[model samples]
Target: MNSTSSSDSNGPKSFSVNFNQDASSLQVGCRNGYRLYELSSVDSLELVYSNGAEDSNLVERLFCSSLVAVVSLTSPRKLKVCHFKKGTEICNYSYSNTILSVKLNRSRLIVCLEESLYIHDIRNMGVLHTIRDTPPNPSGLCALSINHENCYVAYPGSSSIGEVQVFDAVNLHAKTMIHAHDSTLAALSFSSSGTRIATASEKGTVIRVFSVVDASKLYEFRRGMKRCVAISCLAFSLCGQFLSCSSNTETVHIFKLEDPHNSPRRSVEESSWMGYLTNYLPTQVTDVFTQGRAFATAYLPFCGVKNAIAIATIQHQLRLLVATESGVLYIYNIDPNEPGDAVLYKEHRLDAVPENFDKTDKGRSSSPQNIEGILGSYAGIVKGNPPGQMSGTESDKLREMAAAAESPPKGAFQFSDDQEYPPLTQISD
Candidate 1:
């Protein structure tokens, strides 16, 4: 959970917004306290719980369950796990430094500080493992998989570069390292199935997706190259077929991960001219053609504010949800057949509690209290790339090929279609 000051002068003082593991619920922490909303409906949010006893800067709901992890502004160094439905604090832990972020799954709950992380068993709220002296993560940049079986956690492996270290939280060991980018990583997220992870560097230009099983580069999408902006969030749809990225800019980019074979075909004339000039052009220019572009984009009513995004299916319609720190949630309708701008459908002010809210109605989330039912399984494993398969550096190869031959190298144009990686699967519309 990260806090950002409200950019709108008329908005609340300061707040933070975070979606639960599945985006089925949203938690907004503010100076007053926090509010939890169930997003099962597209037109309105069902106010599940609200409390103003203490100011909270971080609030993470455990996948629509009764549990929630909270960090208060008055006590930044402490973490409180409470059963929001019961209004009872289950447990609280204090740290040596201010808590930067807290992530939770059904099996594990991780508390991240500036230089260390504590992994706790969610069943009992007891410390199971400690990762000390990790690279400095001032923003507490880390993600935990919702899948209880695989239970992979990813954090920045290096302070200078965008290297991601995936750890098997269940087995408690290092899984693999992925050199995602040259710049420091700004945001990363796991697909619902945990088979793929998306990463965005501080540069905020190109977004890359890697196979969790082998740490191989799967798809690279170009956001823009004009000016750099801070990326606020990276989210994979629940179906794992679409990835949504929100930045400081007004636009939210949605990239399709569906297999190209099943996607609606486009005429070759619609392709960019750069696609045919890859061998003759510089890597920087060819990179634009080689990478995938956004399948759909949605414009925000406001800009320059930190926001989090999620893609979900609501009443059989694909909707993109954007929650900004300024205390507003925007819902956009995405057309599967269109490859352009998404239409804004609805907007709700998170701070506005519904008139007929019922705080005692725990029946909405009245599933079994079992950990397996709350978390659900959706994760996988990954190994290092095989020999001779370049994990990075497309520019170096292009430069060498330019100096070496008059003709294009053997496979200079087939970057995305390389047989080394498995083809991406398409999700049914």
Candidate 2:
């Protein structure tokens, strides 16, 4: 969801970076405040807005919209929704625990905690539903569909194994459960269409793609056989035709979804040693070799640092954007037809402000938790119908009903589960 790393004690304090849903923009949060940049082109990163009043640990933009969701490191339990252009706080809410991750789309906003999830209507910021007692997700890892038609939210279904629970944010129910891997889950992502979901386990040797509708396995990719890597990000291209994965290593792997054999270049061949041994080895042993390999790879300047990556098409060219927590953005160009190593196009420093950028408030208007044990109180109470096509009237009604519901308080609350069944239950102290 976000990449954070510490610099030298004499250097600037820690900084956090995250890309917008489509990777069209980048947001960097630091000890002083946050900065927003628009990927106007491959050669330039336009500074749209900047704020220095408060310390922001996390800041997310809603597809270039003016609204932004922010969380301060000093008060991680509190979430503030603000209108960046107007510099006004729209609303804020506090949870019983620290907020780990937050995801947003056109229709819904999802806030993930250690063992719970809160779904809010984007229109009114009203609490639509709460998924309590989830598996202990210390990373606060979760993914939301960009397609508002079938807005699905995915999180680790099991703490011991790599299981994914897909929730229908629009319909407000659990969609299905996917047994993604044998090891614990490390990363999760949804295709642009919301029809498929990708996951990687803690082992980080394999990547799996599942059909969101049936929870059926679609594609499996073998990242490496030499070592176990820590996968940090999984992203699908806007066209949903390609998937890119990044890990703690220096190499970023890219895989094609359809017609892999037709690629101009590939990492492995059927006539190679693994291919020859496929007939002699056991089914399980040979299956690893049969799995797909990287269609293309990108090498980073440094490894083991926190970074975020995304795939996008800019100026009719496929691009890979890697933003490292060390305050640098690396842009790579990839030939879709010829799949191999990615070419580094340009690199931008996020820590530096451009001379032409405005520093005044009057400048251009800018675009912008929980305990595991207490969660056992209510387990299966959260369920939902399979997401079906909703009529316009039905969709509007759902939004209206959500907007009419009572909203949480506009500030922080020190909640206790014993005093209230649900942590957000408003009670006067």
Candidate 2 least-lDDT 10 residues: 372-381
Off by over 4 Å in 2: 1-13, 260-280, 361-429
How well is each residue in 1-429 modelled by candidate 1, as lDDT tens digits? 122332543364466999888888889998889998889898878887888779999998877666778999898887876656546554466777899999987678888888888887664454668888999999999988877766888999999999999988888988999999999999989987777899999999999999888999988988988456889799998888899998988789999986644544323412656445676888887777667779999977766788889998888999999988888888999987688999998988876667676655642343323322111110000111111222134224323333322232333222123111111111111
User: How displaced is residue 374 in candidate 2, in Å?
Assistant: 38
For residues 24-127, write the lDDT of model 2, one tens digit per residue.
88999987888888886988888877888689998998877656899999978888776565554545677788999999987788999999999987655567
Q: Candidate 2's C-alpha lDDT?
A: 0.77
Candidate 1 structure, TM-score to reference: 0.80
TM-score of every candidate:
0.80, 0.80
List clashing residue pairs in candidate 2: 113-369
The lDDT leader among the candidates is: 2
lDDT of each: 0.74, 0.77
